[model samples]
Target chain A: MKARVTVTLKPGVLDPQGAAIAQALGGLGFTGVQGVRQGKLIEIDLAEGDAATARAEVEAMCEKLLANTVIETYAVEIA
Target chain B: MKARVTVTLKPGVLDPQGAAIAQALGGLGFTGVQGVRQGKLIEIDLAEGDAATARAEVEAMCEKLLANTVIETYAVEIA
Candidate 1:
């Protein structure tokens, strides 16, 4: 099974990288870029057999180390 | 409008970061963790009114800066 994990910052968190990106866009002449928030995408290829099992395991991984729950939220997709 | 951009390393590209992540997971005692690839997720908030226009502009941003086209591929989603 293959799983895709998306980890994004919670709202109201300070994102200096996002701010820098938005500013850079303006400098690049790309108008209308108001805000930019950056996050992480992790793809895991597993030898596991069942989708349910893989999803459950990956969720554990997210909770353990893949994501920082304090400032980030994560979603998992199994394929 | 809001746009979500996912940037991932192309297949066959060497990803030292991914390898390091997998190794770290092993140290954390998470078994069955294999083939970990890390990527980026960027969310952009736009003042633009039209979804199509925002998507188009965000695509340009990805092509020019958000992604390194030589080794990474990017996908943009507008909401």
Candidate 2:
């Protein structure tokens, strides 16, 4: 099975990289961009075939290594 | 309006960061991990209300700044 994990900053967390991108977009003459927030998209190929098992394994990966947890949040999807 | 841009390395491209993550997962004792790939997820706040227009604008942004088009592909979602 394949799993996708999206890790993003929690609300109110400051994101300098995102700010830089937004500023760069403005400089590139693309108007109407008010803000930007950047995150991580991780795709994992798992040996497990069952969807439930894959989801549980991926979530454990998130808690253990995939996410910072203090400032970032993660969502996992298994297919 | 909100726009989400997911940028990923094209298939066949080597991702050292992803490899490192996979290795780390193994070190952490999680088994059955076959492989891993990492990408970027960017969320943008737009002043434009129309989804079509917002998507167009975000795509343009992707072309101009967000994605390296040579080895990276990006998808834009407007909400």
lDDT by residue (tens digit), candidate 2, B1-79: 9999999999999999999999999999978899999999999999999999889899999999999999999998877
> DockQ winner among the candidates?
2
Evaluate model 1 with DockQ and give the value.
0.86
Q: Whose TM-score is greatest here? A: 2
Per-residue alpha-carbon lDDT of candidate 2 for residues A38-64, written as tens digits (9 for 90 to 100):
999999999998999899999999999
Report how far residue A19 has shifted in candidate 1, in Å. Answer: 0.7
For each candidate, what is chain B's TM-score?
0.96, 0.97
lDDT at position A26, candidate 1 = 94
lDDT tens digits, residue span A1-79, model 1: 8899999999999999999999999999988888899999999888888999989989999999999999999999999
TM-score of 1: 0.95
Question: Taking the candidates in order, what DockQ does each have?
Answer: 0.86, 0.94
